[model samples]
Target: MTTLTPAFFAQFDQDRLTAADQAHYMHGYHVFDEHREQGALNIAAAEGAYIYDTAGNRYLDAVGGMWCTNIGLGREEMAQAIADQVRQLAYSNPFSDMANVTAIELCEKLASLAPGDLDHVFLTTGGSTAVDTAYRLIQFYQNSRGKPAKKHVIARHGAYHGSTYLTMSIGNKAADRAPEFDFLRDKIHHVSCPHPYRAPEGMSEADFLDFLVAEFEDKILSLGAERVAAFFAEPIMGSGGVIIPPRGYHKRMWEVCQLHDVLYVSDEVVTSFGRLGKFFASEELFGVQPDIITTAKGLTSGYLPLGACIFSERIWQVIGEPGKGRCFTHGFTYSGHPVSCASALKNIEIIERENLLAHVEDVGAYLEQRLQTLAGLPLVGDVRCQRLMACVEFVADKRSKALFPEALNIGEKIHRRAQAKGLLVRPIVHLNVMSPALTITHAQVDEIVETLRSCILETAAELQRSGQYAGH
Candidate 1:
């Protein structure tokens, strides 16, 4: 993990590149010692639904470039759009009232696509900043409206907001809120995850829904209606093991938030831009309109860094009142970077041109159906999916819903095997996740399922032989 280099850097040599990566390239949350000898996976090139390593091995990218590549990869038109924008107007100051053409255009496009009166957009570098900005905007809104006491925020257990201090503080994930790292402990609260699969064994789905709604209302009242500002949630929790909430969960939670004057902030970083067969999932899929929607990832299809904190007209009337001489006093150097905005504009155009939204509805269903086949496997505890996004939870005992020991690194093992067998999946704890490009074909879906099946079976056999997994 040395950050110092002695001599001149070599860019072309593979071994030299690996050495440089080990010496200085710092990646997030990676086990440095574990990959100290072998180095990292060197991604060299990417095409539609596939990525190639430095050594030229190809993988059907099942994780969609970390759940962002909705339009797939290596689109020449996307490249042309980016290049054209760069050549036309590469950079501009998004400070104060100054703006660029692409930035203005992208905002208008996003406003049109987003549901409800989410007409105002605050652009950011990525999802993390979008969320961070949204919270700050909430703070501004609360303070301006003369309710400074309504500062505390409510997020759910097992939520992933961002790596920023405030976002991490509110997010209850263990790694984000680790003991060593500092987080705002007092400003955040958590409710139970709305996971139907992990709900009380005897509780029916309807009862579970009622219980969640009651619990959410109870959390708000317990915090005091005047003290809570907002409830932050993902439509389907993405990083917390792709936990899809119970039916009617989003609408009910929004209702409760509405009753208590708490704003609903939907974190649709992974769900927006065609991951769930909709441009946005909150209103269209779940029937709830959030006050603030934090979005990124698929915004530019992972091509350029871009994200937005889209706010409703109701919020704008308070904080954006022109007559009041209001100053929101928040922004970034690359808040509305012209090149990034141009890329996003092109990405949306491509999605429309290809009719990715309709295609996702058709193919996403097929993917969910195909993944159901994995439930028959012994290692699988649950096969949960929300349209194209999916996860396979590993288990030691199927009937009892027992998890395998963490030491086994079961998800990583399966991920490595699947990658070798020509598909890539995301490994989060004991869960193997998939979120392929929206352009993925039926054949690609079949390839993913079959490769995963073989990989899981092989992994099980190897674990059994090593006495790590008991067949009984």
Candidate 2:
């Protein structure tokens, strides 16, 4: 393990951080005061696939900093690019036909790389804003066609779009919506998730795919096709446990969307920029061309905040019509901030110049194979992987596939164990997820597998000792 010297802490004034200050800081997605005594993991620095905390402890970031840091951490080239852009032009307004050179160039590059008539780009601050933009655009397009009733959206269970009100409404995680966000828009409806592991017993994969498609079509019909605005989906569900869909599922769902005149929106916030070894997973991996695609995270490798909603020519023609008297009237102050655009341009150049996509294709397969070997463990119920994204689900009985009681917090226990062993993985309920940097190597893969192996073994032993597990 690599440790930083005391001199490193001097540069950042680490002496100022106290337990009282930490207690006052409210962290997102975590229970307040849950770790008040221990304090949060104060990340000080990072390089490549490894991160160092304030105590100089090194850890392998298997979750890729919330599944965004694709190229890797601490790339000097990316930093220089951002600095150079800020020195030149720090910010610019994207509205009123005003444009910046960097943003213009980035849009052109993205359009050239995108598939099938997806040429128009609308920039935003992050994934949630991109999704919010897409939803509004879908409604605008329908209203432009004099079909104001087509405002309802169709989303699948276990799918995560974003955190904004509209995006959160489209998301299907029941826990995310309960008493707190119960006031989210009701126009969003959810269909079944095409999760192979959760499929009913005696059902073949082909049958399951058909059933999921039917469920989607039935929901549209039940809602009345004229009232449905769009269908939003992730190529692979991310925060909802990395659920990979059955084969040919997305294409069939696209066909249903076409039949019902519902726009298909692909949420590639976590899967784009080589996560699936492709610039965009919609056409390259899923074999479907969506009407709109919302992307963030990997666009700049999480070095800077940036998001974009790419539109198909078919939708653009209506919104871009010259006869329209009113403006779109929606934008963010940081919408095409030149610094973020510059960083994204440099990030893409590095990914292309390094041929990281090819690297991921080769290394990702090894990761999947190594993770699959854990299925022999008594607590490993299922291991699913596609490219660099993966999930390991824990259960009480492997044969019966019964999950441990929620109170056990099996995933969190495994996560803590792995972190102690110099590895970090995201715990989503009963699953441990991995979406490491695209630059991770075979040797690093070995470290991850070994650490995960030990963590699972320790967790199983703890459970058995506490009478929570009854396995050999």
Candidate 3:
């Protein structure tokens, strides 16, 4: 409704193009009715930490292009690398004994970088496929190990793995539920989310930690350890409100998985590639070396569609065993596509050569600190974050920490307000999630925080004027 007149859109008949878009191109996870009425922002271009809408609006992309774009945008080097690979070999059949150099090199680098002995890499199209592949690999491994009954998988209630059928089943997020879509509920189970802030009213952090671990173990037992095959988790629960679980939660859960002989799959689609100032947060921040790590997004820095399912030596010894005549018949056609592998290699090169990880370590802490200063604001109930990844949960009553009614669309209100003032954040229910580029400077972090502060304040004023909020 702001009206778009971007240079690119000018070349075409704007009304006709807009009509074409509305008639076709159904978007993902979008409300079609609302979209048809409000239209869309044509993100024309991007550079560094900011994106330009067709309406000539430049906003700092605090969502980091949906939790990817680690090395930031419009990198000529990335473009060159991808183009070079395309001219050389665009597609590589990964079936049978066929191989490609780029993918092979990528595998070697990934193995060297991955924690522990997670050396085997199964490349896929995106995070969903990568996680789906991991699930299938778990099924194949458990069955090959003669434990055909171990088909059950355990995941946390708020955790998000992916959108694929198998990954959706493992992910117990609100969107991945029954009625709307069928899932493998009989084979997959969920325990409570390990969010400290949302723990029972009287439960202390220590008590919450104990409860989570005990509940996890109890869930495994309830499913019968012999029937439980694996447990899936995101290190920081990215889509589930940027949740940083209680201290020592991952390690304790890993211990439980070890005791029950259940494999731990760390889904690092959003956490890896410098988002947390580490390649992977499983072992560095959480003290757990998972048997498998499903990663994408920043693997190629979102320059290309690529995902990898990293497997440990223990499982590979079973799945990759010689001459069993049992073909691990699960694979994707685009697995290890030469261009994606090349992009990932170059992305890793840029991350290392520029020392973006170290940069993130310094500036990420600064961003979190600046964001925490917003806790005094009227609508802010919680400012939970880890390094560059963050979430600001809003509430009608800060004292009681009571959420605004879902119909109020508090997150969307703040998001629109911020976008109008040159900032962008992902609206997840009642929270606004942020994951800026690793290249963002400390000054930019200050700008993001200050602009966001004004947005929240402005929205609170509007809501109060309308009698929707009783200020804290």
lDDT of 1 by residue, 352-446 (tens): 99999999999999999999999989699899987789999998888778788777778999998998888899997689988999999999999
Q: What's the lDDT for candidate 1?
A: 0.89
TM-score of each: 0.96, 0.97, 0.97
Candidate 3 lDDT over 328-402, as tens digits, reads 787788889999999999999999999998999899989888999999998999998789999999999987789
lDDT of 2 at 23: 55
Q: Tens-digit lDDT track for model 2 on 1-472?
A: 1336877755654445646447577776655555666667788889999998776788999999989999998887888899899999998888888999999999999999889999999999999999999999998899988899999998988888988767888898865765655546578888887889999998999999999999999999999999999999999999888899999999999999999999999999999999999999999898999999999999999999999999999998887788778578899999999999999999999999999999999999999999999989979999999989999999999878898887788998999999998999998779999999999999999999989999999989988999999994
Q: Please give the CA lDDT of all the candidate structures.
A: 0.89, 0.90, 0.90
Model 2 vs. true fold: TM = 0.97
lDDT of 3: 0.90
User: In terms of TM-score, how similar is model 3 to the real structure?
Assistant: 0.97
Candidate 3: regions farther than 4 A off: 1-14, 175-178
The order by descending lDDT is 2, 3, 1
TM-score of 1: 0.96
Q: For each predicted model, how many residue pairs clash, with residues at least 3 apart or on different chains?
A: 0, 0, 0
